[model samples]
Target: MSEVKKIATRDSYGNALVELAEKYDDLVVLDADLAAATKTGVLKKAYPDLHIDCGIAECNMMVVAAGMSTCGFVPFASTFAMFAAGRAFEQVRNSIGYPHMNVKIGATHAGISVGEDGASHQCNEDIALMRTIPGMVILNPADDVEAKAAVHAAYKHDGPVYLRFGRLAVPVINDHADYKFEIGKAVTLREGTDVTLIATGLPVSNTLEAAEMLAAEGISAEVINMHTIKPIDKDAILASAKKTKKIITIEEHSVLGGLGGAVSEVVAETNAASVHRIGIEDVFGESGPAVELLKKYGLDAEGIYKKVKSFI
Candidate 1:
């Protein structure tokens, strides 16, 4: 069998910036001394003048990006999730989100998948934090294709955007020609009636595998890749809830105020179905290999399959 191709979404973020820069001259990338880690170094290498290294100050980087946005330049502030969303929460909320600036926050190494970085670096609550802002658009792409598309969409958007990327190299699932990516739309990967598996970010591929496992056991599972957490695809969620009646939300972030929470809010409003959230329970992550951490935390394919089987 051929080996599956894998690429980190952070790499995609950097490559996307380089690609977009060729077309949009006003595109600027700022990094908090993490250009290499966040993959923004690719942009610096290609277009030296367009990239800025803002030292280790994440808060100041956000403020600078906001200021640049006011000058008609689309600025993407790149940094680790912990610093961008956690350390610089005040600046992100007040300077960028409050004013609704067209600054794209490229937050890489999000969630427990940040691996050996341990609890302090793993930012599992970034989605929750970004969602609280009034006009902040959150995009957690599942694979390389989705991530690249999301970066382009973020540049076109005229408001604040939080683009969450991971350090782990995930499988390239959406590599087909007809694959489409929109800001506030959900992509249905598989259709079934037994249950619906709504997933975001790195857990999306695992959720698809779980659906296959459920099918082997004579259970039909619908799979939906929810790339956009904020301004979620409510109509799609409602339709799936109405059809399956049982929904399971999977994500790499925390269960509270993340993708699971967002889906639950919509379902609860209409009382469409029951939602079982699968993600990092309210706790800190431990240092380990990224793959092992995912397996131990029940975010892998086998883990997701076992959880869905028990839920059924």
Candidate 2:
């Protein structure tokens, strides 16, 4: 077995920004007094002139990023998911999404993975809120490699993008040289015929582990990394549905309107597969260890395995 590397997606985002700053001279970063937590402080350290600390005002930080975008500056705004997707939603909707500004919103510490921060900080509805915005592209990278690629992708793509990152240190899954990441396209991690496990963010690694466990028990479970949420790859979902005939969607988000909801919409339109969504129920998260919260919410590998077995 190859050595597994564990890294927080927020750390990957910070490193990617530092590299991106070298290529794009117009790149600017804005943080809402949470640069250390969000990891945007890396950019601030390297390129202090291009980074702005907008106090603790998330709403104003978003608008400021939007204003900078008008001047041909590609601004990557960093903050917790709670504020970026919840508090500054109006500014994001009106200033960025509505006008189609070229700004990338880096939402870190998203979902139950935020752990001890409790319900107030845990953002289970960010994906849902961002999906409601017109012409907004949502990217949820699974691991370090993909997170770095996503940052570059978001920078190249012209428009409003919400890039979701996590605080937990997840294992590096897509470390091979041939693993390519295309926005809005799903990547099949493991091929199988019995069932399909579609997941995004940190839960993707858990789903892959569940697939391994399922394989040992005479079940061939296909695993897919649906990194992009909005502008989701409907074709991939349908194709996997045709082969597996049964699907299970998992995420670190609410089961209501995250990856599961997006996959359900596609499956309902073109396939007859029975889809089971594994994620946080329609409830607020409580303070606990990140791993403990995942298990309690049935988003862990074991929890996903159990749910998938029953569903299949």
Candidate 3:
């Protein structure tokens, strides 16, 4: 049997820009001197004229992208999630988000998966921060296929968008030809009647594996991949909640204001079902190997399986 393919979504973000640049001449990429790390250097190497290195000033890069948007150019500002969403919060909120510019924020290295970079660089709060901005679209792709598709969707979108990417090379689960990526829509990967496991970003493939473990013990689990967080698929969440009666949200972010919070809100509004959130437990991360951090935080497959089993 062939080994499962793995790729960092950050690489997908860069490759997607190169592909889109071939089609849209007005598409510009702005990087904060960290193009190599964020993978925007792929576009820089391919199309020098289309990529700009704005030094280390993340806030300035955002304003530049906002300005470029007014000139009818779709600008994708690339940087680490810590700087893009945290350091440039003011610029992102006022310059890009408040004015609703046609700018895409390619925030790579999100969450504790950033590994040796430690907690300071690992941004677990980006999703929550971006979610607060009105009219801001958020997409946290699960794999290479979904990440590439999300970049295309962000380019087509007319307003501010936050695209979250991870440093970890995760399994490419959505590689099938029949798979489709639509903004604001959730994809159900497995169907079960016991409980629903809704996951986003890097934790998605792990959640699927956990579901398989649950199946072995007669705990039928439904798995749903929620790529879009801001404009979440309410209908899908409602349907799964009503069917399963128990819901568990998994993400590589904080349990607050992220995917778990979003799912809980939907279930709460309609009282669809009970929700158990699995993510960073509202604490800071420490420096460690990416895989070890995930294990310690209980975000890996075996960890998720144990948590789900206990929850059941």
Candidate 4:
């Protein structure tokens, strides 16, 4: 078997996007003035005619992408997660979500990974905002391979898709695995009967680490990589709930309306008794390293392992 190496999601997006552009001539990339940060500059260099930088006008970029969706072209509006989800919510909701447009929102520097940029640049509530919109597919890839699969899946998918990528170079988790990223499908990475840890985005990597630690402690921990947060794999979650007595959720987003909230909604109705949430704890992020933000906000691997182990 090939060794699975960890890679950052944004890097995967950059590599996969250029590949997609080469394969699909209709694949166009538009940035709301954040081509470099969002890694769309590679596509710009490769396909200058197919790439457009909208000069910091996120609203116009959203409208233009929607317009392109109405036509035959496939558009990916690359930008910081905060601006793409916060500044252009209406356009995303009305123009893209409402029409179920085939536009892909390639959001980079998501969550506390914005780090030194402080709270203003961090997308704490981005998942909450996107998950609320109708007909929008939410994908928070865990690693490079998953991010690449998500990019290809978004192009194959018919409706609007939101891809949240981080700036940090995380340890590669999906690099050596033979995996197929499916929309609304949850990946069961490890099996455990004590507790189930369902995580998305950056936290999925932490979840894997936590699961390994838990295993050493004689605690069987089931880990689920729920990349698609919106159409969250309900059946897989419920299956875990039935098998495992406890449930834990981890995400690089707020505790309010993110993966935890989505999983809670499912488990609450399913008569689940033990539920724990690991996230930003309904607080804004601080200006620091991503690892520091995760620890301070109780979203890191050690934090999750401690909390999950308490149940056992």
lDDT of 1 at 34: 92
lDDT of 4 by residue, 213-272 (tens): 999988888899998997989899898999986888988888899998999899889786
Q: Model 4: residues >4 Å from true position, as ranges? A: 1-6
Local distance difference test, per candidate?
0.96, 0.94, 0.96, 0.87
Count of backbone clashes, every candidate in sequence? 0, 0, 0, 5
What is the TM-score (0 to 1) of candidate 1?
Answer: 0.99
- RMSD in Å for candidate 1, one decimal? 0.5
Task: Please give, for residues 1-312, the per-residue lDDT of candidate 2 as tens digits.
Answer: 967889999999999999999988999999999989999999999999989999999999999999999998999999999999999999999999999999999999999989998999999999999999999999999999999999999999999999999999999999998999899888999999999999999999989998899999999999999999989998889898999899999999999988889999988887669898988888999999998999999888999999999997
Q: Please report how far candidate 3 places residue 137 from its true position, in Å.
A: 0.5
TM-score of each: 0.99, 0.98, 0.99, 0.96
Which consecutive 10 residues in model 3 have the weakest lDDT in total? 173-182
In model 1, pairs of residues that clash are: none
User: Candidate 2, which segments miss by more than 4 Å at Cα?
Assistant: 1-3
lDDT of candidate 1 over 31-130, digit per residue (tens): 9999999999999999999999999999999999999999989999999999999999999999999989999999999999999989999999999999
